[model samples]
Target: MRTALLLAAFLCGPALADRQSFPPVDEADRDPSLVEFRETLLAKIAARDVDTIVALACPDIYLSHGGDGGPEELRANLVLDPQTLSEEYREDADAMREQYWTDLENTLSQPGYFDDEGEFWMPHQWQITLPASLDAHLAYFVTGQNVSLRQQPNRDAPLITRISHEVVILRDHQSSAEYQRVLLTDGTQGYMHSDFLWPMTGHRAAFVKSDAGGWQLCTFVSGD
Candidate 1:
């Protein structure tokens, strides 16, 4: 009987795990200094105040997995020089630059948390850990409450269900599409609004306080 119960638990485990939810919790208020710092930094980002933004960054701010991260790279990314782009990408230079700024603003606007090290990271969902067996690249989080999962990729389509803060698998993402196709863990496939789904590997930012008691932008990056 014990062996049979163990097998039953094993068989039921995946479904139980699939129903797990990660709700957003913002611990930013735990530190008043971080609140002030983030507010100022967000305003600077909004105004595209390069000088202020650069100054707020740590000397060795991390921007990517293999990027040579620092103030210079941050400036270049924000400035978006057309000449720096390859011939093919130059035509879309303006849009690309705008996207950088928009992404930064949106990322910073999300709720955040303070780690054990006291460093603050934004988009509270970033802290969710996926199972090792799941492919991180294909996983996404529904960052909305009572979000519609439609039968088709349109607003008028039939509603399959409503997903809250849950993990879903996305095989392909069309950047220009208003809705994204996703598969729930229970094998229910449907469409969700693109805006409600945040790629598990999406951009997130971190703020760390220096010994001098001032916060700095320590990391702003995406991907695994």
Candidate 2:
């Protein structure tokens, strides 16, 4: 009876108003608690806290001196926790959805979306499908280049621009649509097309600059 009473008292104890939000410790500051850091990062992104992102991210986050296109472009790459998003963020998500749908509608309503290149296709803009399945989250790749990889869907154009954290592929005949996309870690997805992805049957995707650039051999579905 006494133990039960003491437990009840502990449960009913007064809440501490002075409880720290994030723990202030050496490890917390230096090592950065992953969960807490992720949460805080998402929260700041949701609120468009560009200053916080600039402070937290490495010096070469986007490689434009941390002040490239500012918060708007940064927010484009950010996905927030659905549970914690503010009403404004909810509205923003809705807007993004609306924009995507609008773009799709515009493309589909064209004179010949599937056949006519000049009618439906625009330079430097594309809507390639993501390679891997994603959850409720939506993602897209935008090129800073003018020309796409397709020379009528089966040839390589000139190297337009350098894509960071991305690999380029040369187009050739006998390429398959299934191998058109560049796979990503975390089972997410990336961009590539039959026009750009050089197919190698029974061989994993390899990065080679000039067919010889910064190359890294990857092992998918293999325990490394």
Candidate 3:
């Protein structure tokens, strides 16, 4: 309760006495508590206070491909050191540290990014699914369908694989018609058909206001 008030105070700053409002929702019925919570949480995110960020989470959290289950793990994930990742994934994870946080802060600061349910549509977190010689390359998600992988640049090369889903992607440092290079999550280096992969918005973190009017993260999952 005290923490929530402190956060509200921090955001309100003496600059203005007027209560700030959220992005206007089209729906007439919106929860005031949820709106307030979302505003406070976004404020803390812009400030990059990971500790307070962790405190805003529910006891059980769901951080896809990154972390899960409780505030402690979420804190660890946020402040995770590259050395802490598995030996193979360490290098890539460390390389992405800067961009990841930058995107996160950017997303948090965007208005109307949240829904009626107060789920925040965060920026995509590009991850290294494996340890490969990707150099300083980041991963890209496959956003199209019927994507093909060929053994060589030609259309007649052996069909290595076909991607039939959205958002399932590999780390591709380079692109070409003959060989669309990719690194799988299991350290497999191969070529997929070119032009299927594209970056997409990341999953959402849903926050619910507790009985005390303090907002807390309840769930997280891949979003549209």
Candidate 4:
């Protein structure tokens, strides 16, 4: 649990015992320091507080998708000064900032974007690992058929459970294109064929921290 994140419930489940490891993140892998910064950043973002946002950001922030720089670049892009904008540039300027912030705000609401080093490490475009205990908040139903919750990603792995049609399979929010990793209510974690599940609205976050104790948000994105 974290100072800000204590507001949410938590989960505990078994690891997917599959051969093909799911690429999405997991609750077990999170860094509390990163999670705290994420929650605080989200609050500041909702309030549109630029000063506080920059204070928590790394001066040399890395934007993998957009401009590759730090606070200077982020502030330049996000601060939409109407008086400075030319008539023609006004529309695109506002839209660009809007889209950028919107995407980030959306991304930060999900989970499992951080790596072992307490740094954000989502290499893929869209991925989420459901929070360990918050499965009740978002889940997927085993659709149309009885699906085997496998111990591993492959078909040969041992079956953890036989899921029936519309059975609410609590997702760990960890995802891959082919197989989605999930957890049973009984605390058994495993993989479900991605095709057999349906996902709901979920939120996740990202971070950038240096060894010298600089903790801040790099970016945030949300997915299905």
State each model's CA lDDT, in order. 0.84, 0.29, 0.50, 0.56
- Model 2 lDDT tens row, 1-224: 00010111111233311111111112222222332544464465456565665455432223122445333333343433334456767757756645533432332222211112211121111222222323202222222232243223323543323232222222222334532333222222233443323121111111111222221111111000
Candidate 4 C-alpha lDDT tens digits along 7-44: 12324333332221222334524566666766788798
Residue 157 alpha-carbon offset, candidate 3, angstroms:
32
Residues 102-137, model 3: lDDT tens digits: 645544443323444544433222221222322222
| lDDT value for model 3 | 0.50
Q: Is candidate 1 or candidate 4 better by TM-score?
A: 1
Error of 1 at 164 (Å): 1.0
What lDDT does model 4 reach?
0.56
lDDT of 2 at 141: 29
In terms of lDDT, the poorest run of 10 residues in model 1 is: 1-10
Which number leads on TM-score?
1
Candidate 3 structure, TM-score to reference: 0.44
Tell me the TM-score of model 4: 0.46
TM-score of each model, paired residue for residue: 0.90, 0.20, 0.44, 0.46
- Model 1: clashing residue pairs? none
Q: Worst ten-residue run, lDDT, model 4?
A: 1-10
* lDDT top scorer: 1
